[model samples]
Target: MASPAGQFHPWRHIITFLVITAALYALVFFTPGSTAPKLGIDLQGGTRVTLLAKTTNGTTPSRDSMNLARDIMERRVNGSGVAGAQVQIDGSNQLVITVPGQNNLEGLTRSAQLNIRPVVARWANPAFVAQAPVTTAPSTTGPAASPSATATGTSGAASTAPSSPATATAQNEATTPATGSSTVTTASSGQGLRGEAAALLPKAASTTDASTTTTASSPSSPPPTTPATATPTGTTGTAATPTAPATVEPPASVFPAGSNPGVLTQPAGSDEAAFTTWETAAKAYANGGGPTCAQIEYFQGLDVPDKPLLACDQNGQFVYLLAQTLIPGTQISDATSGFDTQGGHGWIINVTFKADGFKTWSSYTTAHYDRTGGTNPPPDSMTAFTLDSQVLSAPVINEPITTPGTQVSGSFTQQSAKSLADSLKFGALPLAFDRQESQQVSAELGFQYLKAGLIAGGIGLLLVVVYCLVYYRLLGLITILSLFLSGGLVYAVMVLLGRWIGLSLDMAGIAGLIIAIGITADSFVVYFERIKDEVREGRTFRSSVPRGWKRAKRTILSADAVSFLSAAILYLLAVGDVKGFAFTLGLSTILDLVVVFLVTHPLVALTSKADLFSHPVWSGLGNVARAGQEHRAVAARLQSKEA
Candidate 1:
């Protein structure tokens, strides 16, 4: 039978270490693609963009707001699968973003300003219309002669108009003119007010003489005392010029007419007379042939949140007349990507609003939707969602979204839906950001830095190997082999972590690994020194190995525990590249304990039984003092204890 001290089963520990090492190697090699840890921006070239925030009030943003924006931007970047992206606030109003690999910089930098507003009117972009071939012949007279006219004719005149057969038929059903009244007819139900058909209604009415009159009235001005009329003499004759009516000024309740360019108010009543007049004036000013860019800029400069806005979609293919803001983007509390299973509309962004947002949304929808519980709602009952002054979507409010919130469905792919959801979930930045700089870091520079780091690490590791061999001599072989095993295990763990958790390795992380070499060596030295002390006190080398391990294990564990605790604290508090250093340090510290107990201690214990350890010089324990004064002293103490 084996002696009690010898029965530690050291071979079992060796087997366990070998098995674990083999398993880790298999995992590292078997993982598809590159098994190396992912590299960060400092080690791998990537794009960097700097943004300067522009506050509405022209003042610097608060530090808290900038930090909040940075955090939100980080979440958005990470959620988009760009892991290890760096977003930092520079000064009070600047943000610097660095991301690895090729990414959508435009999407990353979007303002994501979500605004919900009522749809007053919508028209096909004139540019888009002009690009398509004109199929219908031009009308000879009346509203058809002028693109600026805002009248949809009564049933009789609607037939003679140059509008397509489908348009006339749709308009006839949607609008009904009051009998004997020359005023243009409009749908009382919001659902019926939609598209070109609604816009054509006012133009259609221009065919009648009485309906063509422009009213000039405001809150301060009394109603027109006498109606001015224009009379045409021939079938295509020019109208007899009538006396000009008084200049009608906009009500003070909205714009003061000349206060700002393009500022307009929502017209009241179901007739939509005021909306038609404003639409006509806006189209003439916006679509005039001077310069589309200049026109758009002028309109954008004058956009007011509480007033109606005339803006185009991002593609500029459609223009929308948007009502006052109902709910601002700040009210959006959360957003997520989902599929519209019921409608088979592919992907969509689900938005949740806060309590105040819910109340605002509920009130708006209740006002726009048919409260009579009717099946068909009005077409004008829709709300448009805008980002950066461009309309993203305009969905009709079928019912009040009183639950969590509503969904924004569009012609969206999975990526686009997720991107939009990420933007909305993060909420809008407190201020708009202008791109200050955009540049790409070349891979060559990153590779050069990486090479330098690797060289430094290699040199440090080499010095450690030389020192161990010089000091411990034959025993250093065990330390060297243990280090080799620990290195393999640590590398495999890094690769696995990168594959599973998107952990990226950078220069700082390499420094952490280099530091671990020293830490790991210390544990071996402690164990070996403990064994040397035991031998000097007269215990045989074979018994001293096991006795030394028990004494040294506690010290090893305590030191490693402190190192791990410090690393944990650093990782939790640090940001940017420093986090990489802390994480690697903590990970390597754990693996060091595994290697020490399993590989290093067992090998030392088993080797103590060999003839090499019998000689103090060969065992690297110095003079053992066998049968000398130290041994006699130890023997005397043993005898006294037995007595």
Candidate 2:
């Protein structure tokens, strides 16, 4: 190892420090769009939303599920293009989400309930669509029937359908058309019929007429004689022509009792009758009428995977009647959003399914899609992707999806697409969630808190500076310069960290920086005191500087190491605001050591070589050095007498 005197290269250390400081400042201000360190939610103000989960039955969700929910929620908030958002589970069933600045709390929370159900049918909302007049003529092959016949009772007003067994049987018999009655048949089923059926079928069915009427001079093929028609009594219509009767099948058995006992088996048969029955029941229930707040509450309480569901879109502009879930949301393995370059669809979400989900999805799509290029594919070909019982998207499957991946394409903006992709990728929550509270913090209030924190820090720094100057004399200038260097390094590091790792500084972090001042000052005082002691032992100022630093180096290392370890422990264990405090404290503690070695010790040693350091008043240790010389002379006189 080099001797203490040879180790003092004050110019080299000082020059190196200047270069580093210049580089840090360049990174802070010269980088494109670079700014000061980011501020936390408490310092910048933001919105907080609390959601309470509701059980399908009546119990709390498992801890694992709650944790999983929190993680998924965090991803969703982050994916929405919001930074520095925090998501945590409160107690057993509540989730608290905090986001910087104003956010769509409803949109963020609604994504938690991902329901992947098969779309039984879909149609545009007439209330939201332009109304076109319809021309009707008597059917040549069948009878004249009103196109709006089935639309009765499907008005916006709430209406009830037959529920009791007796009423249902009576209504079914009354609505059934006679075999020989005049009926109109179209090439398609449920086309152009108004009311419940209109709402259930795809948009393609809305433009075509249900009647089989053909003009006398028309060149089209003759209409089928056995065409089906909408029942005159406004009941659900059957197919234009019925196929052979289906074989009698056994009723579906009940699922085994468990936490969820209502999971129903897939009903057998691809017959038109089975499809018609399912469609009719679903539409009647959905179109029955507007639900009351109590009814909506009751519906929200139900999350059974096996039962048919009735829900409205997020905007509540249209209601949906969804079939039992063919593939649950949990089966989805991953989902990502991007633009469809080849297809030219605006934005799309690509979804990949697990093994079981792949099988279910492929089978469902195969059954509904028209493999033979048939003119009319079943309405069930379309699938509805819902979140919290609201349909996010409903797309028709043109071909069977045999692979594990599928894409949902629509006119989606980037933000909406990403939000949906994130929600789907995270899978569905086990329990449903209801918004409990929404709180907003104003920017002005956050600014006030930040100002107060800065003022407090400034006061503490001022007091430390005053104390250092009064006691250490000229050495106080060195202490102040070391502090300045340390502060500069810390500020640069904070800015770079914020840019790269999203490390935001809050009021608690400011407090940590303030405390670091004393820690740094203590190191300076330790080194200066050690120098005074060496001078008192008859050492020159130049020699004492290096000797003092050599002795104080080990003590400084030990003290800083302990401080760093404590800060590390606190940072690792603490959460939220406390973490910010520990992080800054730990970071500054490391910087303290750098300043001492590179700036403080080297500067002191260089200054000691100057004549000003020998003056009794200019040099803080002049008196101590004089006293030591006198004591040394007495010791020498005693030794000479002994000789």
Task: Indicate which candidate wins on lDDT.
Answer: 1
lDDT of the candidates, in the order given: 0.61, 0.59
Considering only N, C-alpha and C atoms within 3 Å, which residue pairs clash in candidate 2? 158-289
Q: Count backbone overlaps in model 1.
A: 19
For candidate 2, give the lDDT of residue 188. 20
**C-alpha RMSD values across all candidates:** 15.6, 16.1
lDDT of 1 by residue, 112-171 (tens): 778888766554444433333322223333223232333332221222221221221122
lDDT by residue for model 2 (381-448), tens: 54666655555554335455556766555446676777777778765555567788999965544888
Off by over 4 Å in 2: 1-8, 31-34, 40-44, 50-94, 100-439, 443-449, 613-616, 637-643
* TM-score quality measure for candidate 1: 0.53
Tell me each candidate's TM-score.
0.53, 0.50
Clashes of each: 19, 1
In candidate 2 the C-alpha lDDT for residue 238 amounts to 30
